[model samples]
Target: MKSVLQQLPESVLAQILENAFQWFVVVDKNSRILYINEDYCQFLEVPRDQAIGKPVDEVIENTKMHEVIKSGMAHQASPHYIKGTYMLANRVPLIVDGEIVGAFGSVVFRDMNDWKKLSSHVRTTMDKINMTSHEAPNKLYRLEDIKGSSKAIRSIKETIQMIAPSDLSVLIEGESGTGKELFAQSIHERSERAEFPFVKINCAAIPEDLLELEIFGANIEPEKHHRKGRFELADNGTLFLDEIGAMPLTIQAKLLRAIQEGEIEPIGSNMTKQVNVRILAATNRPLEHLIEQGKFREDLYYRIQAITLRIPPLRERMEDFTELANTFLQQYILKAGKRRLVLSSRTREYLQNYHWPGNVRELQNVIQAAVYLAEHEIIEPTALPEQLKQVRKKPVTQFVNLQDAIEDLEKMMIQHALQDEKDKRIIAKQLGLSRSTLYEKIKKYNL
Candidate 1:
């Protein structure tokens, strides 16, 4: 028996598809448009001839054709925002002979008024719920988003999986830009509270004067308007406190109380509201040292650190370096709407040799810059930043005596440390020397 498509002529079938769907498009496995109906071309204000062979994303605003092709999954009645209005769209992979060849997609709604009516009804229903004006931050990352396969990363992932089911407080410690927040989000996503809001606040970013109001909510002096704090917003969910070390000692006491009692008193309100919030705190600095220095509260430290996950810096996991670099490279390449590009062997060598002082975040920035600077399909050392270009393999040196060799090594170490760290105290601490001894060594070495 012949199928309907097989029985119909090619031109008739094309016309039927063009008129039947409000808007339709088809893209090959590479996300390059293979066929686009006349209606979609007219809507995009592009000629049919010009639309074909171009990337779907370039022609259609916020199109998921590429994602459908990549995932080989179908998106049915998904809300798609185009221009200024939201429309339902369906995207499905086009398979032939058990192989996905491309993707076929179309807008589901033919009448704009119908969609507007539905959208308005949904918004009205949401408004009735009295959702907070200050929306909870979206949990944009998952464990898969961590993007590393090193033993260190794998062990941390395993630990997160094991601890996610429990309600224990998690203290994530890592250097700045090591993706502590990503791990926090992953834990929330894997937990029982995954359906609830994953609220986050950066202690250092918020002003100290306003920080209390931000966390504990407040009633405006003149307006008498009551606002919900992060604690209330994160009720029955996870609250991620980023840069926890930077939280003021004054606020620390209240935070400890909330964690212990499961209640929060708004700034102006006399009554305390009960909230069930799972706390997940992250810090780039050593909280223990801060406690000793009378900066961070010791009790708060013990409260938040029921389970600790320490993320190793990029330098410590060199095995995942190339993979991470390539991942970032691909992301930037797609963002720039450019063809596929690869890092040259020499470029990779330079990248691996350089000490990533800024960690993963720094590497991502470097890759983004290199993607735009690259003139060819390959990213060479020339495309890297000036500092990265200056990085070179150290040469073997011969010394006259052991003392001379030791002194040279000491001087070299100091030079590298100076370049890596901006704080002299941190450098001294890392080198196992006191501030005075480090200064004397620096002066003696003329570093």
Candidate 2:
């Protein structure tokens, strides 16, 4: 037996689909909208032509047609909100010759009243959650976003999962470029306090005198512009204090009192208010050294350091470079609207060998730069930053024994550049030698 779609011409088939689906859309394999019904267009307050060829995300308020097409799986009775109304939707792959060619989506509701009842129920739950505006930060990164399999990163994730449920104050210690704050936020997201607001402030960024006012709420004597302090805003939630080592001694005493007593006195107010906030602190500085120097209070240090987690820098976790590079490549490629891109073997070696002082953050930036700068699908060493190309040329120390010194210098430079700038041609050019001569010297020197 032939199906209606199989028997009818494409022009008649499209008209039949438009009439049957009232609120419907069809997308290509790439998740680009190919067709939208007049009913959906009327609800969208736009013309049918306007919605076509745009990505599904831009076309629909909350649609999963793209995911359905990508995974070749049908999603039925999925909750999707449109124009502030709750709706149930079905998205199925449009298969051709047993191959997924695109996706078809339609709204599923008994009537308008059915949608209203469901929407009201969901809204009640949302009101109870009361998610704050600051809760969802930039790029919406979480634990899964770490994208590394190195032992150091694995341990960090494990430790965070273990400690997140507790109400203890966590002190995150790491170098400037390491993702200390990312781990802290992941902890907050996994904890029981997930429903509450998550606020963040950098201690180093605020002035010493203004830091106190920032912690405790302040009322500016101006023409009607007011602000809430961190404690008040973060009540019953998590407050992330970044660069905690730079906090003033006076502010530290107040912060310690607040942590111990569960209360805070807002600036310009005589009364103190109670606030129940989980504190997550981060620092790149040495608190112990500050304590010894009489710059930091021991009591406050102990209060905040109930638990300490140290993040390993990228240089220490080159084993994770491959995954990290690919993760960044895919991310940038999607954003750039380009096809899949890959790093050459030599480029990968360069990434693995370079000392990333700025850690994961630096690698992400370098890759983002490479995605746009690299001319071909395969990223070559020529596509990397000039600093990476000219690395290891500056000697760390002076050497004696001219012939031995030259050999040692060559070996040191090669090793230094082995991970991040591995093209032999580039290496030869940097060292002022031919490719064959460079290989001969590497063999002679056993480097």
Candidate 3:
């Protein structure tokens, strides 16, 4: 049997190898080519009969494959040797017993013609195998879980819940960190098409040149193939466009076309595929301002504003500060694995008066910081960040008694004079007051 196998014709052996793979090649210990399948010949741009007895180095001279044989080890590279290519390969030495032998390998080619196809194939495969890719479509957060409980916030949540089942495009207006996207998610989860995808696209995140391709997708570069945009991904579902005010005028036109027609056409393709998507757009700025400035499209604004929802600033909803603070404290305590903490009466009082420039988002961040920094289970004023400390300090004085007020004013005035004049004697002269009076106020006020 060994003699018969050794005496087998090259054509018969090549036929067996071809049945096992698309391509195959074999070499002796001398690194001379002993066999080449039809696929291998075509891949190397050589004739099978002519390549059979030739050295692999001569067959594909100056190539990385030759280096593999020379070093007697497996070698792999990418976008290598061949121009305009991207390749992944596995090469392994075939050793028998204790004797050294030759090797075999395989390559998956990635060129301009096949890169898109390969990438798409990989994405589809991964999506099929990964539970995360297909589950619970849009991201989730709740209205009750939202930080505020003031009349404005209660009314807003009630409106959000009421409109949750509707298919109308929701326009969420709020400043940064007001959680417009959270509102968008709440709507989608409650909607009739909750099982479908909830695709999000940040209109302000992408460059104008690429935003078109990102939103409507493209096919001009065949290497990238034709991709489906957010609208397509959210078919029978919802699409959230953040910072909608920053979207370019030209792209706005395309968006309007898709909304009106209920379909999108890829950049390089003329065919339009119907998409069922309800758009929820959010922006901190006024769309009317953008329209007046000629920065946003008027028709598109009307299309997206079918049902507008405005979120009031934290300063405007100051009545909810304590509730928001307590809720945040509970969350932080649980997350930090600490004992339940009650806010100090002073802290709660000061919190209610804060302007909260970053709104609910800022409040959450502040409470979280305080929880981690607190020495005791109770959150004290000192545990807050330096910025919050400054905010709370100024506000706490507002609630002080008349004596404290007069004393604080006296201290402030003297500090200002000293800062301005750079000397206590000069400050007394500048304020038209005696040095003894200045010294007395300083001592009494603890300046």
- Candidate 3 clashes between residue pairs 3 or more apart in a chain or in different chains: none
262-310: candidate 3 lDDT, tens digit per residue = 9998888878888888999999999999889999888899999998999
Q: Pick the candidate with the highest lDDT.
A: 1
Q: Using lDDT as the measure, what is the rank order of every candidate, best first?
A: 1, 2, 3
Candidate 1 clashing pairs, residues 3+ apart or interchain:
none
Candidate 1 lDDT over 1-447, as tens digits, reads 468679989889767987898789888999999989875764554556668999888888889888887888899777675643355788999999989999999987634435445666544533443354235344357786676655578789999999998999999999998989999999999999999999999999999999999999988778878999999999999999999999999999999999999999999889899999999999999999998999999999999999999999888765567557766876676456564677887998789888888999999999999999999998988888878766766434354457755765676687568646756689999999998888777655433
lDDT of 2 by residue, 1-447 (tens): 477558888888767887896588889999999988876764554445557888888867667887898799898766665543345678899999999999999987624334445666555543433454245345334686565655567788888888999999999999987888888889888888888888899999988888887888765666533467898888888999999999988888889999999998777666778899999999999899999999889999998989999888777665566657766776676456455577887887677667887888888899988988889888898879876765443223354557645655566576455445646678888878897887676554323
The Cα error of candidate 1 at residue 272, in Å, is 0.4
lDDT (Cα, 0-100) at 353 in candidate 1? 86
Write the number of the candidate with greater TM-score, choosing between 2 and 3.
Answer: 2
Stronger candidate by TM-score (1 vs 2): 1
- Candidate 2 local lDDT, residue 22: 55
Let me know the TM-score candidate 2 reaches against the reference structure. Answer: 0.61
Q: Which ranges in model 1 have alpha carbons more than 4 Å from their true place?
A: 1-139, 392-447
